[model samples]
Target: MVVLATKLYVEGDARERSLDSLRSLVDNELGELDVEFELGVRHDDFPSVTIEGEDATVARNVLREEFGEIVPDLESGETYAGTLESWDEDGIVLDAGQDKGVRISTDELGLGQGSAIQIRERYGLVQHMPLRFVYGGDGDPSRLAEEEQDRLYDWTRGDGRLNVNSATRAEVRATLNRAGHAQDYVTVERIGLLEQSVICTEDTDPPGLLASVGEYLPAELRCVVP
Candidate 1:
């Protein structure tokens, strides 16, 4: 069994949809390997898959490479994927499943993103956005992965949108409708359980949409500006 570091924290119908999405993602990545697996969610909401049949080890490695392995310790030179849990002037804290939390200082953000808040705003680094990181040992500096940097760069290039957490796709859509802003966005893309990216229409300002409909959604919403 391999427990992935990412989380699935939605409830009700959203929970079912998220589980189905996860199963499809894993299956598409591992189906060719002839592995039989059972997927489940733990109490803490982390996704886990137990594999059986021939070539199970190969299947496990495939999953680990696609998602990240949950670990209790951080070692120098080790790479990890974690949720962006919180941030302050000092740095950002990643919920990497550590006893405390993994800390990434402002200076380590690199790529000319400036302070922590600036980095978050510049990249649309919404809370619970899964990000890859490399850890450096004591007195050494850790950094975000190049792939992560590239992904953020891509988000900043197109029609910017709002990324939201702690709400279902239906709820978000309904909130937009209720707020009389249904025509402001193009679509809502579900990236994880309780997480979505609202693609804005050409005339819609992502930040304006966020401000107008945010109060009704009851979730944390951040805009990605192009």
Candidate 2:
């Protein structure tokens, strides 16, 4: 079965109830088409949901029925953060990275290359580095792209001499050499090396592979951005 997820934007408060009803209808109707839901949509709420199915046509019908008027069609990938190259003045043109963070800017942000844009450290794995920026809808940082939820299962660690999963530390200089990230992720190893007191999310820290991401795992197994 193919897994699918979407973050949709509804109209307004007056339509909230109607939107929810629509969500229910879509969910039920799509089920007949063999579509499974991971999350559902909401009105006045840009809710994100993931679904799985064998037929693309059925998925499209449900999408169009519920959101065709407002969003027209459900777009692919996260509308939020990650996988971006650079940003200009008005908006971001999109980077080569895998994620295209939700467009949070109001004034277009130009999507220009000349604009120096930095990744917003919004979504993080428990005590781990942020995976993406938390974007507000239409100017509000409300919903987290459904794709971010997928990354929650990711326990991959950063560069440096020590690994979080193994509970071992090595000389900072030595770790950087083996890391795929920049020197910045390397220099901070000392701090996260011993931060095992709290877990921001569930235990996804796969054993071995150096920074297995266990030390930072929160009890709930969610993302820890701060």
Candidate 3:
């Protein structure tokens, strides 16, 4: 069984829809492989895939590569994926499937000035958004992965963006279209299963777009102004 790094925190009808979407997504990723699989959510909300067949090994690797895996142990200096669990003036915590959350100090964030919360806002990081980090065991300080930092930095260099949580990529796209702002956005990038980033057009205002569609999406929205 391989636990997925992404999360599924929605409840009720939305949960069912998200699960259905996940099933479809899993099929899309492993349908070609000769493996039988079952999907289940852990007590902490991370989805796990159990596969068995002649191609199970390959299937496991495919799932791990596609949706980062949550391992049982952390190796010093190794990179792993975790979901944004909380943030504070001191630092940010990532739920890395361990008894204690992984903490990355504000200074180690290396995302420029301000508090951890400020950094989160600046990067438009939504709660439960999957992030990569390099583990520094034995009293060493952990920090965000370079690739992850680069990705967030690229968001600020683009034509602005509205980052959202608790909504699927398809749901976000439909909401934008329904609100008559289809032309305002370049695309809805899927940050995680439920976290999405709406890349705006050159003239579109991220905050304005968020206000227009915020009421429609029963989700958290944050704007990244360039």
Model 1 lDDT tens row, 126-199: 78767788887787877887777777788788788899887756767778888887788888876554677888
Per-residue lDDT of 1-226 in model 2, one digit per residue for the tens?
Answer: 2211222222355235434544564566576676666544444223344556576566765654433222322234325332222334434332212234344341333222232232221222222222233444344533334444444323223221222211212322233334432322313322222112122122222123224332342121222232
Residue 41 CA error for candidate 2 (Å)? 5.6
**TM-score of candidate 1 on Cα atoms, chains taken together:** 0.80
| Full candidate order by lDDT, most accurate first | 3, 1, 2
Candidate 1 lDDT: 0.80
Against the true structure, candidate 2 reaches a TM-score of 0.21
User: Whole-model Cα lDDT per candidate?
Assistant: 0.80, 0.33, 0.93
- Give all candidate RMSDs, comma-separated: 3.2, 16.9, 0.9
Most accurate candidate by TM-score: 3
Q: Which stretches of candidate 2 lie over 4 Å from their true place?
A: 1-20, 40-44, 69-226
Error of 3 at 219 (Å): 1.2
- The predicted structure with the larger TM-score, 1 or 2, is 1
For candidate 1, what is the total of clashing residue pairs?
A: 0
Q: Estimate the TM-score of every prediction.
A: 0.80, 0.21, 0.98
